[model samples]
Target: MKPLVSATFLTLASGSIGAQAAEIGATFEKPCPFGDCSAGIAFTFLGETSIQTGFSEADVEFGGISGLDFDQATGRFVALSDDRAERGPARVYELDVDLSAQGLQGVSVRRHISLLDVGDIPFAPQSVDPEALRLGPEGFYWTSEGGGSSQLPPSVRVSFPDGKHLREFALPDGFAPTAEGSSGIHDNLAFESLTMLPSGDVLVALEAALQQDGPKPGLMLGSPARMVQFDVLSGKPKAQYVYMISPVPQAGVDGEKAMNGLSEMLALEDGRILTVERSFAEGAGNTIKIFMVDLSNATDVSHISSLARHEDLIVPARKTEVLDLNGIGLRPDNIEAMAIGRAGDGTEILLLAADNNFSARQKSQFFAFEIVQRLQ
Candidate 1:
């Protein structure tokens, strides 16, 4: 692959809100540093920028962003804040991105919708940790990593544009919180990634291994993360596959491996999928990588409760590396959201957003890339 041209970073700050004084800011520039890229399927780093918005009209709360989705009908971006209403009410924001030949021109907040529960009330604080967002036939589909201390099981739910809950998906027993039984999920590690395929199937990926499956990732070896595919309309499971997670890149606090888990995925028209594997080093920053997964030869291990560590026993989905953000000259942050932009001509755009954790040391960042995939 060719090296990216030299560029400078730009930082812009906009005016504040009325009395609450919400601040909106952003910056854009580029300098791709990927090396020895492979062929067949690849992504060209278009550009990247850091964005911050605190508009009273938009009700934008600068917290960790965990999910992202695009509405082609209205050309707006829908984003989910991982906060469970602690900092503010659980909400989603619609944004408008101005794109030009140079790269991303600017970003503007359009609408902010607060999530509501069955009784038509705002979601109670510390109740649901919303993680993923997608446009569905009914309206917008969202997923939450249920609170572990409260023994709340992770869930997928649908709601109208106004944030009124329509229905919740029935999850498998294995996904219940640890307090439920021995086969449930680990604390803070549940359904973190979600995607809807073109074939009317929704894929939900577990953040880490289940209590009955195996242990979490270690210093050198990785752990197996399970992915479940189900009928979006009926919520009936159709298939399941194992996705191995790489170990943390560096040591963590109190002598533990930092963290490495599946963040998001994009279902392709050809049945295969592109997934993001994110790793965080306590002191080294983040390592975000994209893999193209081939499901043609994947085995459905739904019936098997505990997958053996035998090298030859497990047949996981085949993965091929397509992009790595570490080498792209952009500061690595917690990237939890990924989405595919509307296709134009024969090319498609991939958009990525980072969660800032509402910290002054961190930032809410965004990146864009163009993908060129040929029909095989």
Candidate 2:
């Protein structure tokens, strides 16, 4: 898909700025309301440098990334960007990776899945790009930008490495869907960030905030950021968890604090799920929080919800500061993409990627950390 949006509304102070830089427009494989495109705004990668686009103030090629996935069986990395960096009928590329040598600078042999010919679904809007994706038991599963227009179920697809085939995967009921009317329907949707567990369970982040297309245009935004499980074959949503972004220390989160923004979510193999919460709404202290929630033990995420009577389950996530130690500023915008991997010695690495909003003011960097197992 092309970048989510060509322009972004930035909230800046001398020390920090909170807002999405530019978003990649959603596109399928061919030109149409739904097609593959290369118009991207930001990128996240799993290489030697781990989300290392760390430029705090630099102009970047927009429409650079749509989503990312890593193959555990082969250590191969695939970053889906708007194909050809254009605005329609985009293609998905598969990158062969070897992090053993390079960091974010790792080398990748690339392949493309052209989506210029998939027949459009009924009632879908024009220019919807494939914004986010996940690697499923079947293959790659993704969501588009159309859940805003017609309640079209988030689009799911499977991409096989053979390159001769790319198929569409259908979204079944209960898997959870996103609603529009928030700040913008451009990048945020019903199921923006998706992840699958080794146990066959799935977690999806519904950008339950407003679906309007601008910066903080709404006085208020709301939605239950949901996580659900589905049967591999039938594609039925089996379970769900709902939660919220913390209301700033002063917002007094006495009501339903909305979980409006998220760049990515990763399902830990140990049954815990981690997420990057990018709240642009007023009163939400926007940060790249890596939450460690035990979804295996809880069925409903209401426990994680901090309503007037509930206590939020999200703990104070230990974040890797790319500033001071790294010179990156405090507003690391959208730094929540994740990957579960192993370092050379076999210790598990929780790799988190941040979206720098591609503005001339933030860092286009990524980070990798060892999950201080035992959660001390």
Q: What is the C-alpha lDDT profile of model 1 across 208-277, one tens digit per residue?
A: 7877777677678687888988888887777889888777667776674488888888887666677888
The estimated TM-scores of all candidates read: 0.83, 0.56
TM-score of 1: 0.83
TM-score of 2: 0.56
Off by over 4 Å in 1: 1-39, 53-60, 252-257, 308-312, 342-348
Query: In angstroms, how far off is 109's CA in candidate 2?
Result: 7.2
Best by lDDT: 1
lDDT (C-alpha) at residue 318 in model 2: 25
Worst 10 residues of 1 by lDDT: 21-30
> What digit string (tens of lDDT, one per residue) describes model 2 on residues 18-98?
333311121111111012112111222123242233321122232235466766775655555432223323444454433
